[model samples]
Target: MKRLALSALVALGLLAAAPAAWAHTELIGSDPANGASLPQPPTRLTLTFSEPVPAESATVTVTAPDGTAWTVGEVSASGATLAVPVTPGASPAGQYVVSWQVESLDGDFVSGKTTFTLAGAPPAPPAVTTSAAPATSAPPAATSSSVTPTGTAGPVATTSSTAGAVPAEEGGFPVWGWVVGALVVVAAGVALALRLRGRSG
Candidate 1:
């Protein structure tokens, strides 16, 4: 009778422990599978859990090798799957890390991390070219009106004659005054000869 009672107690204890073990959530699998190497980055990350997780209580973060966050938008929970979007072009060629936390069916929190490496180098950035502006020519200087042309003749200057000045010879005497002196000498000789003839008669 004691053996029968001990067996019943042992069965009840095992049953209670089984439910506690099954109620705990665990990360069973991932889309990029842990320790995976790929030629390119993925657009989204998916995590499979042993039990359904509440979307509001779940958080997933993806970090690049340079320690930059790559995850975007809200974490979505559908049945036993949790998914979050990631930027495809943001990460370079290197190892990436995914860290996640979720509330289990038993109201306990579970957190874990996984890592993956990218296979090749990231695509080279597009070449940048800058065009220089066209050179502008300065305007020509203005020409002055006071300047004379190279092959042209300048103006001639003239002086006006005086009103009452007489025209003189090279000796500084007038030609008309010399002629009148000669006429006066001839008249005096004629008058003296006429007086001598009257005295002889």
Candidate 2:
């Protein structure tokens, strides 16, 4: 009976340690490469992970050196790939940070950041084309104003919470939370079973 009790304690100890063994979703690959220099920004940023990720509740933020966000579009997912559209902008020759938070297959949230640099001077904003119309020629600014953007840009989500509720993207405990809970339940069942067996013996 004493030997069985020691074995039960050892089993419980191992069970408690099991949750620590799991790690969060890792970034397997990325387009334009992490910490790389690019002359021109890519149309889309793609991130591939070790496993397929869910599409909903994923966010990517690309902030320029001047404290301006260049992520002009929404995030889309296809298979293991997560793609975000970036608008054309003059990113000065300096380091830029891209941080992202995503959900893994196990319903756990993971986040990471990478930095990349832009070399060479940014090109001057495109010159305004003039037409034969006197009204068009007089107002270069008016011609620029006529060009309406495709869609209404949505507000960017920042890490802030009000009323004591955690944001979905930034909140949530690690995957180990569920793993630890399950292990604790299993340990309790094993302990009960061992106690019953020892009494019968």
Candidate 3:
């Protein structure tokens, strides 16, 4: 009778411990809860689990609709909650998926995913304006004067403007020839006077 009682107590104790050993950590709730919609993106993602999680073994990834990563740094934990920093500038107005894996106190890793949507479209990118360059005008062509040639060969002669100048007739003797004849007449008169004086003496 005593042996049968001891076996029954041992069976009851094993049955009670089995459930606790088989249980694993599970996600309970999240901030920006699943299927939530917001006008703007959240700065951080918070996840709650059934038990405490370790920061070193927890992993969280936040991805945008276009497959761009939005998570910034390593995962952080506070008891049963985990917080992940998110980059709001990189996240546009679209659906975002959060995938998380955490190591529970029972040495089991639990993973799940949640999604949220942003309501309106993203703001338009800034406009790009280009300035037009100023136009340049070309310089004017140089002017040249034409020269008409005279028939003379070596060099063209120029007229002088001296006082008491004599102008030559079309067909006449030059002034220099008249002056030479007057000089010869005076010389002949002198020679005749000298010869008369000698004869009279």
Candidate 4:
């Protein structure tokens, strides 16, 4: 009977200590530290836990002062530490909130939030754009061309200067005067031949 009682006490002791060994995972510290005011924000965000946790059921969000999310993608968890990416241009000035939730190693879902301050983002340089005034090309120099004519001409009739003048005739006998002069010469020759024959007789 005493041997059974001793075994029962041993079992009881082990059952009591089991809860402490399987404790839930929890956030212990962070890279930015709790409520730290940063002059220059960190390149990567980090979260430390009391025990190892899986990344599948984990979620972390870093919110800026203007309520915009600064985390880029899914967070990575290895061992008891979780690492999150800080988006390149997401960080801004003023107060920021770092909210988180993760499944503990014991399968417990835990969630919490913390805040920090940023000094303000650097001012961006002004953009300067200048157009080239549409490239004044002098409007092609206003070309001028001269063209000469070619080909042959048609026939043209020409007349003498005296064609329109009237023919001048004495006593109005232009054609008949030549015929009368020939007949007078013939009659005088006949009369002289008869006078010569009479003198010889």
Candidate 5:
């Protein structure tokens, strides 16, 4: 009984520490906005996040409606913003999807997709006009600290619990937990029965 009590206390301590290191990187915001219809294709693609991300290892891919690859330049990060330059070209009026695989500071790989639309065909110039909005947002750009390592897992799964908490990937505790709980109940019942018989005798 003492051993089991100690084990339960140790498990509770582990559960308390789970929340701090169990964060996942996610797409907090984007430029041109998802499903937004712009007058023309933007000069670049910008993705913003809630935390500082590694810039050097991020991969941003922009594909036009016509299935042509429109990413011309490299991905750059200055602060919490990450931007990729778009190739100069005319795109038919339709939706374009931006897909990215970025490495976070915790050495995890994060990836997501967002879409934007062009109201009309792209203009001839690749240069940004005075009337043209900035390709990126005001928060400054973000990037990975080092080159993204290959084979990193995709987005992470997070779970919160005051008791036993296991990641969704490895799966929650197996059927054994229920069996052990049942045994504990039976033991308590036997103990109560002995106490009643002693009182009657």
Candidate 6:
């Protein structure tokens, strides 16, 4: 009985010294730190744990606010760090959830969640209606189509002003009246000359 009790005590001491054998892996740190706000989405993710996890047994998923998966490539583990390449989805511009489940070296599984947000651009303001009037308003009449061009026809008032531009000759000052006055002056001079010639002879 004394020998069995001693063996039991030694086993208990071994269990106590190796506490990690019974415990699952725990998260130690991560890139794009938990609860952090980033200006944009990260290209890859790094998750560190207290225990080394198997790369084949590790699973990592990233989700956008719309619940779309953005994880890409295979999950890989190197030492105590698990690395995953993320395919940054379109508009990764809101709250994001990162979930992980990995198997520790001791065959125990541990799971956890982390949250981060990207500075999202504000929703575009509703498009403005540039038109000042409603669509149902009636269009104006097309009077321009009915009007015809008269190239030579002008206003009578303007024509009359153009015709009176030059001075008019009166009937009392005709060219025939000036000709008859010249003939009368020549006849009186001829008769006076004739009378002088007759006296000389």
Best by lDDT: 1
What is the lDDT for 120 in model 3? 80
| Model 2 misplaced regions, further than 4 Å | 1-21, 122-201
List of clashing residue pairs for candidate 2: none
lDDT at position 7, candidate 2: 100
How many angstroms is residue 152 displaced in model 1 relative to the true structure, after the best TM-score fit? 48
lDDT of 1: 0.86
Note the clash tally of each candidate.
0, 0, 0, 0, 10, 0
Expressed as tens digits, the lDDT of each residue in 80-180 for candidate 3 is 99888877656567898889898866798889999999888767999999988988878977865444468745554455679997877669888888999
Q: Per-candidate TM vs. native? A: 0.53, 0.49, 0.57, 0.53, 0.51, 0.57
What overall lDDT, based on C-alpha atoms, would model 5 receive against the true structure? 0.80
lDDT of 3 at 94: 81
Distance from true position, residue 27, model 3, in Å? 0.5
Sorting all predicted structures by TM-score, with the top scorer first, yields: 3, 6, 4, 1, 5, 2
The sequence of per-residue lDDT tens digits that candidate 6 reaches over residues 106-169 is: 7777899988889976689999888667668589777523333577464333223565555446
Q: Report the number of backbone clashes for model 4.
A: 0
Which candidate tops TM-score? 3
TM-score pick, better of 1 and 6 = 6
Query: Candidates' lDDT values, in order?
Result: 0.86, 0.79, 0.85, 0.80, 0.80, 0.83
lDDT measured at residue 189 in model 1 versus the true structure, 0 to 100? 88
Report the Cα lDDT for residue 201, model 4.
94
Assess the local accuracy of residue 25 in candidate 5 as a C-alpha lDDT between 0 and 100: 75
Point out where model 4 deviates above 4 Å.
Answer: 88-90, 121-201
> Could you give candidate 1's per-residue lDDT for residues 146-187 as a string of tens digits?
545577596344456899977577866678878899899899
Q: Residue 109's C-alpha lDDT in candidate 6?
A: 79
List ranges where model 6 is wrong by over 4 Å: 1-16, 20-23, 65-68, 88-94, 125-169, 173-201
lDDT of 2 by residue, 1-201 (tens): 999999999999999877654656788889868989998666788888877777678888888888788855888888888988888576677788888889876678999988888887757999999777654445445432233356847544445357876445447776667889999999999999999999999
State in Å the error of residue 29, model 3. 0.8
Show the colliding residue pairs in model 4.
Answer: none
